[model samples]
Target: MSKILVTGGLGFIGSHTVVELQKEGFEVVIIDNLSNSSINVLDGITAITGKKPIFEKLDLREKSAVQEFFKTHNDVKGVIHFAASKAVGESVENPLLYYENNINTLVYVLQELNKLKEANFIFSSSCTVYGQADELPITENAPVKPAESPYGNTKQIGEEIIKDTCKVSAQLNAIALRYFNPVGSHESALIGELPIGVPQNLVPFITQTAIGLREQLSVFGDDYPTEDGTCIRDYIHVVDLAKAHVVALQRLLAHKNETNFEVFNLGTGTGSSVLEVIKSFERVSGETLNYKIAPRRAGDVIAAYAHTEKANKVLGWKSDLTLDDAMASAWKWEKHIREQ
Candidate 1:
């Protein structure tokens, strides 16, 4: 079995991907700083997979530590890079931190991969790179708009960095999975999104409000052109998104005649408005959410989903979970977290 390195493996998506990788018969090694995640995620992952991955408490920003990690673990077959500062509002407030954490860590990881003879590099890119696209379902070829925040700019820059690295390094084959809104949790509620501080995403806020951890959810805007006047997004289950990483890694390892730097949009190809999501949560969890309409948030796109055809045709993957299933899973995870 090939060993795969998962940076930020204890995080919401990273942990879920670890479980999928293990289930697919891949040996897993995890490196997480635990700055934004809990060590207990290891326990949760073990509870689900019946096997705990090899974990290291190392920060990727420190070039030496990352190099040492690669040096010590020379058998690593591929890397799923998920370690980054990912908050749009916080990125706008602190651009330097975002640049430092997001860019530097990627550089260090690529530096290590360049030394290997054969290695696959998977990146966690975002739909924010599209900014506010003119089309409804964004495709891989969609024109990338001027990034609305520093965090988004990092993804654009990160993709550029990977492309440039792949141009010179034959050992490196990279895939940038441009993700849309990723919500929900693992089916067992063992590991899920544990956003630090106030949640920036909508699903977390809705879950928190339903759990009574917060006063009420704030619907950023109710005046959009969409139905019920709220912004629309294609929310993919976190587990489904995690499986995409596994598929992409397999694609790269199989040498499927793809470009050295390829991009795929991972989404369900269906848009759901904020009000629609709230209703879905209510229907799934039987909880009425208290929310109010607020002014349009700056940098928010009215609607953004993915074309997803490239991912389906190339990687042989598609989303199987529905919005209600995602909400139910998320509600289960939120209740479990509250109990803990």
Candidate 2:
């Protein structure tokens, strides 16, 4: 069995992708520093998948350590790069950290992959690259507006880095999935988003407030131009987003890529307002969340969702979960974690 390397495979989306990769019969090895994530995620993965993957707690930011890893595991056929600091507000407070963690580590991973006879790379990208597209249902070809925050800037730059590398190296093939918003957990309730400190994303905050971890949920703003005057975003299930990575990796490994570099927008093609999301949670969890509208944050966009035509036709993937489903699973996982 050919082995695949998943950086930050213990984190939220990475852990789900690791589970999907294992199910596809691909030998998997995971490298994580356990900075924002914990080692207990491995037990959750094993409990659901009935197998444990090879794991190394290595920091990818160290160029020397990354090269040593590739030398030690020369059989690694592919790389899924997901390890990075990913909070928009946090990035604004510390842009240097975002640049170092996101950009520097990407360069190191690509350098190691360029040495192999052939390599397949999947990049964890974000929809913030579109930056409030002028057109509704942002397509892959939508102009990448200036990133609103340092975290988004890293993704935009990372895509460009991969594209430029693929142009020069015939042995390197890469795909970047511009994820909109990944929420929810695996249906088994084993692993889910467990952010350290206060949660930045909406779903986690909602769950925490419902479970009494927090006093209230701040809706960010109610003045955005929308039905309910709140920002709207496409919220795809994390498991669905993880499956897209596997499909993308398989496309590169099978030599089916039409180009050395490709980009796809991974989302459900449906946009939901923040108020709508809270209502869905109320319906699913049967709790009216205590939320108040604060002033708009600096980096938030009014709306962004995927067109999904290219991803569906080219990548043969589409999200299959709803906001209600996501809210239910998230509520279940919150209870599970709190009960422990």
Candidate 3:
């Protein structure tokens, strides 16, 4: 089995991807600085996969450390880079942090990968790059709008960096997966979205509020011109999102990518509004959530789903989980963690 490297493997999405990789018989090595994640997540992954990956607590921002890591792990055949800081509100507050953590770390990783005989890279990208799309089901052809925040800019810049690098470096094959909202946890309720501070994403917030960790959930807006006034987004299960990473990596390793650099959107084609999500959560958890409609948040898109033809036809990957399934798993995870 080829040795695969997963940066930020202890994170919510990364951990699930690591499990999927291991299940596919890939030997995995994980690198995490533990900035936004915890050491406990490593245990959750081990419990689910029954394989303890080699873990290094190193920050990618340090160029020397990154260089040393690649040298030490020279056997690594594939690299899934997911170590960037990923909070929209915080990025707006401190643009420098986002640039340093997101851009600089990406540059360091690519520099080392370029030195390898053959490098297969999977970049953790977000839908933020598309911003508020002009069309309803956004596709790979959707013109990337101006990034509304530094966090989004980092993703856009990161894709451009990979695209440019791949144009010249025939040895480097990279895929940037622009994923929409990722929610839920593993079926075992072992690993899930457990952010350190107050959760910024909706699923975590709903789970926490139901668990009594939060007073109430706040729907950002109810005035958007959608079926429901609230903003709409494509929320895919974390497990489904994680599986796509493995599939993308295999495409690169198998030399199946038409271009050295490729971009794919990982999302369910269906859109769910805030109120719809709440109703789903209530239906699944049997707990009526306390929520209020606040002012429309800045930089929020009216609605954003995906046109899944590319990912489905090309990558042979499609999200099978439903919004209700995600909510059920998330609620189970929240209860499991709180009871302990």
Lowest lDDT sum, 10 consecutive residues, model 1, at 251-260
lDDT of 1 by residue, 1-340 (tens): 9999999999989999999999999999999999999999999999999998999999888999988998899999999999998999999999999999999999999998999999899999999999888887899999988999999999999999999999999888999999999999999999999999999999999999999999988899888888789999999999999999999999888898468899999999999999999999999999889998888899888999999898999889999999999999999999998987
**Cα distance off (Å), candidate 3, residue 104:** 0.5
Q: Model 3: residues >4 Å from true position, as ranges?
A: none
| Per-model TM-score versus the true fold | 0.99, 0.99, 0.99
User: Which sections of candidate 2 miss by over 4 Å?
Assistant: none
lDDT of each: 0.94, 0.94, 0.94
The residue pairs found clashing in candidate 2 are none
CA lDDT for candidate 3: 0.94
